[model samples]
Every structure is written in structure tokens, then in C-alpha cells.
Target: MSTVLIVAEHLNGRLNAATARCVSAAAALSPAAIDIVVLAADAATIAAQAAQIAGVRKVLAVANPANAHAIAQVQAPQVAALAGGYSHVFGPSTTFGKDLMPAVAALLGVDQVSDLMAVEGSHSFKRPIYAGNAIITVEMPAGSQVVATVRTASWPEAAAGGSATVEAASVDATLPSHTRFIGLASASSDRPDLQSARRVVSGGRGVGSEDNFKIIYHLADRLGAAVGASRAAVDAGYVPSDLQVGQTGKIIAPELYIAVGISGAIQHLTGIKDAGTIVAINKDGDAPIFEIADIGLVGDLFQVLPELEQALG
Candidate 1:
């Protein structure tokens, strides 16, 4: 039987939903145990939240002042030191995991599995390729510890009914001096986070100038949804690159995804293929976005948006 150790992803003293999604994937393995390791300056709050994830056996709280920030170089050695006695190490396939897991795999002398969507066996898994147009099964060598990133979009979050015990962990790894915490600059928004939001409203180049993006924001606010933008819109300077949703941007699986004035290029479609209900509003009736949209409205967004908002009320 395999023993799985999950790296908990948290920010602002709260656990990320992606960590619970990883728990869901770990549960599919039917492993001997599923434990979460929280590396933070003060892991008590995050560890408490992680313990509530159903199927988790225990939470390992490694409180270190060096872990105040999520610098992958500083944290990888600590995680590697704790990897002994575990058959598998898992992390979410997000920006943080992408940056950290590769280093862990390198330290473990194993190839890292990216975007694991399904578990075929203890050492075999399925993941997407070529912008999600293809899925390939990968098999790890027997007896080799598996290091993988779970695709949070493909798995539902584990429920919160567990009462797992939290244990303090002390890691003795040499910390590198090359990388040091400097600062983080991110746009502050009161809107829902696009990657985790259940409902999202996106705009494209057809939405016109940056000022016209207010229509997209208004509709998103009305629906209490997050705002996203197509790569074209980002490239056109209508919105920030952070809001881009496509192959080159964040992959999300919202229950409701509304694309306004988007033509639905394949790269853009790759991002939301797992979305439950896709609604597209485009002026061109033959727009490719309608091909996959559950609901499509063919009309000028300038005239259609106001009516939709009124109907929402």
C-alpha cells in the first residue's frame, strides 16, 4: 500500500481549495494514508484547516520562519527532507506547485508528473497534452516514489468532515542563501478569484476598448461572478494579463462560464473545456464559441448586456 504526503497550498493563513481537490485525487489512490504537510511561518491556522479535509489521516505542521514566503528554492529542501517513508508526494497543478514540485522531483531523482487528471493505478496516471486535445497515460517505474501535480480542475474538492490529528514536524535541511524573499506585487481586487470561482464572466476583443470592459465587470458583479478575459483581450490592452483565460493563462472549471464577444479560439476553449455550463454571447452567429456553448446569444453585446442585467433583476 502506498503512503501519500500532500503539500498544502495556503495563503493569508487560509487553506486553498486546490489542496482539498488534491485530497480528492489522493483518495482515488486508496492509499494506506493521506497526510498533508503545511510549511509556514505559523502553520497552526493552516494545519487546522487542512485537518478538516475528509480522507486525510494527519496534518504535519512545519512552522519555520524561513517559510514566511512561498519561495520554492527555500521550501523544496525542507519538503525533500520530509519525503522519506512516503511512497508518493503530491501537489496542486497551480503556479506554486509548478514552481516547487519540479525541484522536489529533482531532489528525489525522479521525473515529475504534470497535470495528473486521473489515477490509473498507484504508479500510473492520465494527463492532458497539446492544449488538452489529447490525454496520455504515464507509468512510473516500480518502487520509485511518485511525485505528481494534481489537476484541481478535474477533481472535486474533498469534503470537510474529518477530525485528523495535527503533528508538529521539524525538518533539518540546509537552506539556500541564493534565493531570498523580496516582495510580491499583485493587483488587489474585491471580485471573486477567477481560478476558484464557481461562476465566471469573460470578455474578448469584441468587447472593444478597455473602458468598454465595464460591461463585463457590471455583468460579473450582477451575477456575483469573477471576471476573466480572453488572450486577445489581454493582448489588445483591454484587460490585464492576469485575467486572461486560455491555454497560456489559468485553466479553470467553473460551474458557470459566460464568454462575451469571444470567438472561442481553440487555445481559449482549452481553458474551460471542463466547465459545467458555457454561455457565449457573440455578434457573429457562426462564431466558433457557439459550437461548445450550452447557451449562445448572437447579438451586439452593447445592446444585449443591458437587457441581460435587467432580466437578472
Candidate 2:
């Protein structure tokens, strides 16, 4: 019977939603047992959350002061140590997993499968390549372990209400001293997190300036959607780089994605290709965003945005 282990991602004592999506991908492998490994300074809270994800057989909690910062050097060893006898080890395809999973694979002496989107078999899977323009299928080496990062946007989150047993893991790996936690410089916002939000509203360079971007936010607020921006908007200093959405930024698969003033560069389109429904608004009728939009509106965004906000209000 195949068993799978998912490296749970958490921050500030809260579990990330990506962990549940990783669990969904693991379930696709038809594993006989699925377990989650939680690493943090105080893992009890996150462990309690992990125990609630459906279909999880067990939760392995590793509470350590060194694991607080999510330093890959410390996390990878703990994950690798707990990976024994498991057929597959999974992590989410987020900034956290991107930085950490390869290290785990290296420690286990195996190749890491990047961005696993579909499970063809227990040992085979499909993933994207060339900035998501091409998809490739791969089969893991037989009898060797499969270490993969699940493309979280491609999988629905596993349902809650699981009754998994949580236990502390016994690990004796030497912690790395080369890394230390400093501080996080992040913008605090009441808006939903772009990667996990169900609806997203993005502004592009046509918004003119950072001040003008408020209109986009107004519309987003009315819709109760997460605010995002194109690379141009970010590069032009209208928004922080964290809010940028493109091939070089965050990939999202929201149920509704609305683009205002975006010309829809290929890089930008790559980020929203998985969206359930796309709505594009721009004066340029030929803007590339309209090409893929489920609903296209060619008009002045300056006037349209205010009107749209009022209508929603």
C-alpha cells in the first residue's frame, strides 16, 4: 500500500490553505495513508488545523524554535527524516514550497517533480513547462521515492471535517546554524490574499498612477475581491511586487478574475489561465486580454470603473 507525506506550510502559527490543496493532490495518488508534517515554533495550532483536513490519516507535529522562520535548511531535514518508507512526499507550489521542496528532494537523494498538476498514475504525473505554454508528462523512476510540489491552483482544496490523529514526530537531525530569522516586511491589507481568493480584480498600467489605482480597489471592494496588478503596474510603482500577477509573479485560479486597463501580456495571461471566468475591460478593443476573456468590455476604464463601482454599491 502506498503512503504519502505532505509537508504542511504554515506561518505565524496558522496553517496555509495550500496545505489542503496539497492534500487533495496526494489523495489523487490513491495512497493507503496520507499524513501531514507540521513544522513551526508553536505547532499545536497548525497541527489542530491540519487534523481537520479530510482524508488525512495522521498529523506529525514538529514544534521547534529553529523551525519558526520556515528556513528551508531546517525544514527540509525535518521533512526528509519523516519521509522514511513513504512512496510520495508532497508540498504546495507556492513561494514556501518552491524554496523548500528541492532541498528536501536533495536530502533524500531523488529528483524533485516540479508543479505536479495531474496524477496519471501513482508514479506518473503531468506538469507545465515553458511558462505554462507547454505541458509535459513524466514518470518517476520505479522503486524510488516521488517528491513533488503540487500546483495548488490546479487542484480544489480538500474538504474539512477530518478526524485524523495528531502526534509528535521523533527527529534527531542536527539543525543548521547558518540561517537565522530576521523580520518580514509585508504590506498589511484587509483585502483577501491574491493566491487564495476566489475572486480577483487587477489593475494594469492604464490606471495611470498609484492614486488612480484606488478606483480599481473601489471596484474590488464592492465585489469583495482580492486586488492584484499586472507586472507593468508593479514595475511602474503603482503597486507592490507582491500584488503583481504574471508569469514572473503569483499564479491564481480564482472563480472570477476581472482585468481593468490590462493589455494582457503573455506573462500576465499565464497567471490567470486557470481562472474559472475572466472579464476584461479596456478602451483598446484589440487588447490581448479580451482574447481570452469570457466577458470583454471595450471602454474607458476611468469612466467604467466608477460606474461599475456605483452599480455594485
Candidate 3:
């Protein structure tokens, strides 16, 4: 039986939705046993949340004074060590997972799989290639334990109900040599995090001007959605870099994605292809954005937008 271990993520005791998705994916690889490791200053809180994630066989709580802030420098090696007995290790393709999992893989001398969408066989998987324009299935070199990061939107989160046993896992207090803790900076946003938002309204070059970009926000606010932008919109000075969605920017898996005036370059599409529903509004009906859209409106965006707001009202 192959043992699979999943790393749990939390912010101040609130379990991240991605952790449950990772567990759901890991369970497909092996149902023999699934251990979810929660590294935190407060074990009881993390453990409580871990118990709620479905398909988990056990919750391994590792409490440490250094984990109060839970930076990767200390958490990676600790998690790598605790996961020693497992044949496979998994984490969500989140900031923490992207930051920490490769280091853990390096410590364990195994190749790390980044942004896996589907597992084919025990060792073969299908993942996006060329900025998600193509899909490639590859096999991991045998004789090594699998270390993978799953894109949360690719897997549906399982419903919660498990008699998962909770165990206290131990870890070294010292930080790994290759990393260090740094001061934190905060971003201001009343909206949900870009990755977690369910409804996203994005603008592009057709937005015309920086002032016109406000329409994106107005629509988003009216719909209770997050605001996003194409690289063209950001590079053209219509929006901030943080709002950009593309190969180099944020990947979003919203329930509804509105692409206003975006040309649907492969890079931008890669970031939002997972969205449940896509609506494209572009003057050029021939724009590639229409290819993936569930609803494509061919009209001048300037004329269409205000009417949309009024119609929605």
C-alpha cells in the first residue's frame, strides 16, 4: 500500500479550500492512507480544521513556536521530515506550496511536479504545456517518491465527513540554511483574494483609457466580483500589474469570468481557462477570445457596457 501525505494550509486557523482539493487528488492516487500535516503555532486550531477536510485518514499536527507566522524556511524541512514514511507528498499550487514544496523535494532528493492537473497512472500525469495551450502526459522516473503540486480548480473539493485520527507530529525547531524569515508587507483589498474569488470581471486593451478602466470595477462591484485584467490592459497602463492575469500573472478559477475587450492570447487564457463560465465582449468578433467563451457578444464595448449595467440593475 502506498501512503500519501498532504500538507494542509491555513490562515489563522481557517483551513484553505485548496487543501481539501489536494486531499481529493491524493486520494485518487492511493486510498491506503492519507496523512494531512498541519504546521502551526496552534495545533488545536489547525487540527480542528484538518478534521473537517473530507477523504483524510489522519491529521498530523506539528506545533512549533517558530511556526507562529509559519514562514517556509522552518516549515519545509519540518514537513519534509514528517513526510518521510510516505511514498507520495502533495500540496496545493498556492503561494505557500510554490514557495515550500520545491525546497522539501530538494531536501528529499526527488524531482518536484509543479501545477499538476490530472494523474493518469500511479506515476504518469497530464499537465498543461506551453502556457496551457496544449496538454502533455508524462511519466515520472520510477524509483522515486512522487512530489506534486495540484492546481485547486482542476479538482472538485470533496464533501466533509471523516473520522480522521489526529496525531501530534514532531519537528526540529531550527530553520533550513538556504532560507530566512523576512518582514511582511500587506496589500489593501476589500475584495476576496484574486485566486479565491468566484466571480471575476477583467478588462483589456478595448478599455481604451485608464479612466475607462473604472467600468471594470463598477461592473465587478455590481456583481460582487473581483477585478482582473489582461497583460495588454496592464502593459498599456490601464490597470495595475497586480490585476493582470496571464502566464506571468495570476491564475484564476472563478465561477464566472467576464473578459471585456481581451483578445484571448494564450498566455491570458492559460490563467482563466479553468473558470466555470466565460463571457467575452469584444468589438472584433474574430478575436480569439471568442473561441473559449460560452457567451460572445459582438459589439462596441463602450456602447455595450453601460447597457449591461442598466440591464443588470
Candidate 4:
């Protein structure tokens, strides 16, 4: 009889793949009703996308001009307003959820369960701590609302082809004016999104310079993978910070992850620990990344990359 509501993540007018993964995580709680809340200026378009996520029973769209930017300050209160009648409220453990869910938990007067990796039961769950080094089991207080962030990396995206109902959800809360949407700036790439890409190719300080990083991109494009970078590479001005992958940057779990010239810092390894098949190519055979890599090739990237591109072609 428990009901769960997921806060959908979207951009422009489309749902994020993470939202479907949240639905897949919610479906593990059999017999529980799963619903999604879409908060946007034009929610109908996104709501329709959410409704198509299998395992969802309903989609609630809260359309408002203030919602166009997805500022956590503005959306937290709205999420809290919609938390009623639901025993649990969930969001993806991305930057969006990390910023917003804690506030929702505070408003609900409950401790938030972050990075939920497994649903042991409705109230019992498992999550990671110490940079995913340890997983601990937690139990939500009985009779209290459970607010959690689903770690999209640990679960699979929910399949499409659902026929859930989409309805307009009311938000009667006062809007906060202090938090305003300013102009936004970010790197644009035609390559797959780093976080959701099934295959990824990353570079590090070994890439030498920004121009040399093109070798990494060429290999990535040949493999149809996204481009990623180590913090060192980003700090060295070899790539944009958005491409950095490490404990401090974006965490991803692609099926095939290729590390070219990356020395495999522990911080960097944390980000890709969940990746399915890790292939490390470094000049140093003693590099720590080789210890966990399914395939390790010790060689000079500049020489090896061209050969790979030709072979793949």
C-alpha cells in the first residue's frame, strides 16, 4: 500500500534517462504504487515522456515559468508540497538530487537516505559510503516518510512503452524571489553525455596538451563513446572541467570504459569503479589503474591510438 513519487530530471523539454532508472529502482518495491512529478515551465512535453517510462502509474506535471531553470531553491518547496499521500519521495543521485533532496528531507523532518543502491525492503535499504568503498544498510524511522536519492549507476534504465496517466499537479506554495535564474554557461558536445554514455574514453595529464587530447577524442569517436578527462588533464588546460571524471566530478558506470594515458588516481578510479569493462592504456605498467582493469595495455598513447582508430575502422 506504500506510494512512491519520483522527481523527474529533464532538460529543455525531454526527460533524463536517469528518471527512467529511478522508476526501475522504484519497481523493485513490488505492490507499491510509483508516480513521477515533472516540474517545468512546459511540463506536458516532459510529462508525456515520463508517462512512457514503464512501471510508472501516474505522471504529475507542475508547469510554471519559475520552473524553467530547475533551480533547487525554487523546486524544493514544490517537491515538498507534492510529497503528501506518498510514503517515499525519490530523485536521481545526480547534482540535481544532491542539491534538492536534502532540503526536501529537512522539510519533511526525516533523514534522507542518499545513494540508495538497493531496496532491502520498503523501510530497509542499502547505500554506499566512503566514496563507494563500503555499503551500509539503513532503516527509515517507522511511520516516517522516506526521502532518498537513487544512484542511477547501480540500476538499469526502465524500459519504455508504458501507458501511465498524466495529470496536472497543483502547487499552492509561495514562490521565493531571492533565487533567480541567471544566464547559464556550459560546454556543448555532440558526443554522448558523459554520465549516461555506454562507452567512454578518458584522457589524463599524459595527454600532454589540449591539442594532443584530440587523440583521445578520435579513439572515442571510432568506438562511438563519450569523451572524459582526469582532473589533472582539466587542471592542465587539456580539456574543460565538465569533461573531468573523478570523485570530485561526475560519476559514471558505462559498459565499456577506456582510459588512455590516465595514471589512474584513486580519486579518478572512484568515478569509474562501477563501469562494466575497464580498459586501461598507460605507459607505466605499475599504474594503479591496471590493477582493476579487465584489459591493460602498457604503451605510448600517441603511437597506439592511430593503430586503434585504423583497426576499428
| TM-score of every candidate | 0.99, 0.97, 0.92, 0.96
Predicted model with the maximum lDDT: 1
Model 3 regions more than 4 Å off: 177-179
For model 2, which pairs clash? none
Candidate 1 Cα lDDT to native: 0.95
Arrange candidates by lDDT, descending: 1, 2, 4, 3
Please tell me which model should have the higher TM-score, number 1 or number 4: 1
Where in model 1 is the C-alpha error above 4 Å?
A: none
When sorted by TM-score, best at the front, the candidate numbers are 1, 2, 4, 3
Candidate 4 lDDT tens digits, 48-69:
9999888899999999999999
Q: For each candidate in the order shown, give its overall lDDT on alpha carbons.
A: 0.95, 0.92, 0.85, 0.90
Indicate the residue-level lDDT of 241 in model 4: 89
- lDDT tens digits, residue span 49-75, model 2: 999999999999998878878889888
Q: What is candidate 1's lDDT per residue for 1-313, written digit by digit as tens?
A: 9999999999899899999999999999999999999999999999999999999999999999999999999999999999998999999998999999999999999999999999999999999999999999999998899999998999998999999999999999999998999999999998988988999999999999999999999999999999999999999999999999989999999999999999999999999998999999999999999999999999999999999999998
